[model samples]
Target: MIDSKQKGMIFNVQKFSVHDGAGIRTLVFLKGCPLRCRWCSNPESQLFKPERAYNPNRCLTAEVCGRCAKACNEGGVTLIDGLICFDRSKCTDCGSCVNACPTGSQTVYGYEMTVGEIIKKVEEDDVFYSRSGGGLTLSGGEALAQPEFSLALLREAKRHRLATAIETCGVYPTEVLAEACKYLDELIFDIKHLDDEKHKKFTGGSNEQILKNIQYVFENFPSLPVTVRTPVIPGFNDTEEEIMAIRRFVPLRDNVQYEVLTYHRLGSPKYGYLGRPYLLGDVKADDDFMRQIRAKLREYQG
Candidate 1:
């Protein structure tokens, strides 16, 4: 029996997302991930527990609003030269300052929500789902990392007769992947690199388990629609040889599709908000190079 009351740490519940799944969809971003990819955009989603993020640009100077500093019991927030300064080292992530902030600048990234509550919110867009063939898509730091809660959420979503999907890194146990597929209508899996060492070096986890899990999915669930994506990060999997290695690994079945996602620094600023370093720095993806690779792959396939 699936428990609707089971809670999961969710970072964001993005609405009207058109990328993760078919048509317009509601994306539930789950918190926690096993692998820490250097180019990861959602650094806030990396940790399991909720953390506070301070955006100085949105802060109404300390002179106007010192509420955040006043609310900080740990002396983490302070006013410096008309600017609100946050000392992340002292902050406990208790969310006191986030609550005190009048402007939306002080924000907490992750929060706990029950499957029942999440479903209730998702059902609000039932009209859009019916017309656009879109429903719930679970994205994360890694949805499979939160196995029980994620599975329960999927089951609950299915009970509501909604189309369900998940964007997974496929780094979990095959058992978890097996269970998740039963409830998922679409599977968006990331195959970062075929080489285990390179994969580990870049994403901080070996690709052996990931490859095995993905292979298990294909062999067992032949009917499930799978979209395998490779984020084209410069100095990583940008070369045709590297990308092709992964393309060769994935089976070319009718139900399986492959795509390359261009890397971007869109989430670099978030690192500053979270007081974390953006490892990728000034590196940028060559869109033209990626396009050429895609064309070459098609030609090779033909």
Candidate 2:
């Protein structure tokens, strides 16, 4: 039974997505994450609570619309020399400024939604799923970070006879992951780096747990189809040696596969909105570089 009252923080619900999993899918981006990847695209999904985002281009000047200032009870929004400034320290993310904004300049990132509510939304694309072999795919900030809510969504989705999948970093407890795998149809796992120290330096977490969980899944769930993915980041894990390390760790089998994702700065604009800096500034992974990495990986896999 889907928990109608069990609400979890959600940041986005992208429909008609063909990237994360099989066929066309609806990607449900949950809030909160355990690891702090420097190149994270969805900066808004990192926190467990609702946070505000600002769009300068969409914002009307303070002289034109002072509604946000009026709505902010904490004095977080103020005017400075005819320009608007946001005092993040004083802000509580009450979402009043978001509501008051006329042009959608001020917005909140996370919101609460029950499993039932989410399932209802996903069901809207029922015909599409049936035709294209698509269904619900849970993504994050780390889907398993909110274990209960994520499990509820998975169970509820399966109860409805929908194909369920999850893209996880495998940072959660091994027991929890084991339980979750029972309800999953497909799994996209991330193995960023084999070296624990480098993993910690880049993602702010040890690779011990992640590697342990990956082994647990592979050894225990041999029949389960798993796709191991690595996002090739410049100045981090971009070299052939790094890719070879990952390939050696999780060698492909009948149900296991490997894929590499090229790094991009497409989400740079989001950092400006969230009042955060995109750490990987101007890092480019051109087509030629990615092709070389893939070619090397194939040679190593053989």
Scored by TM-score, the top model is 1
What digit string (tens of lDDT, one per residue) describes model 1 on residues 1-302?
A: 44799999999998999999997899999999999999998999899998878888898888888899999999899877877899988988788898899887899989999999999999999899999999999999999899999999999999999999999998888999999999999999999998888888999999999889888989999999999999999998899899888888888888899998989899999999888889988987787898899998788666
What lDDT does each candidate get? Answer: 0.91, 0.89
Each model's TM-score, in the order given?
0.97, 0.94
Q: Tell me the lDDT of model 1 at 165.
A: 94
Off by over 4 Å in 1: none
What is the Å distance of residue 32 in model 1 from its true position? 0.2
Model 2 off-target regions past 4 Å? 300-302
TM-score of model 1 vs. true structure = 0.97
Which pairs clash in the backbone of model 1?
none
- lDDT winner: 1
Write model 2 residue lDDT over 202-231, tens digit each, in one string.
999998999999899999998888999999
**Candidate 2 minimal-lDDT segment of 10 residues:** 1-10
For model 2, what is the C-alpha lDDT against the true structure?
Answer: 0.89
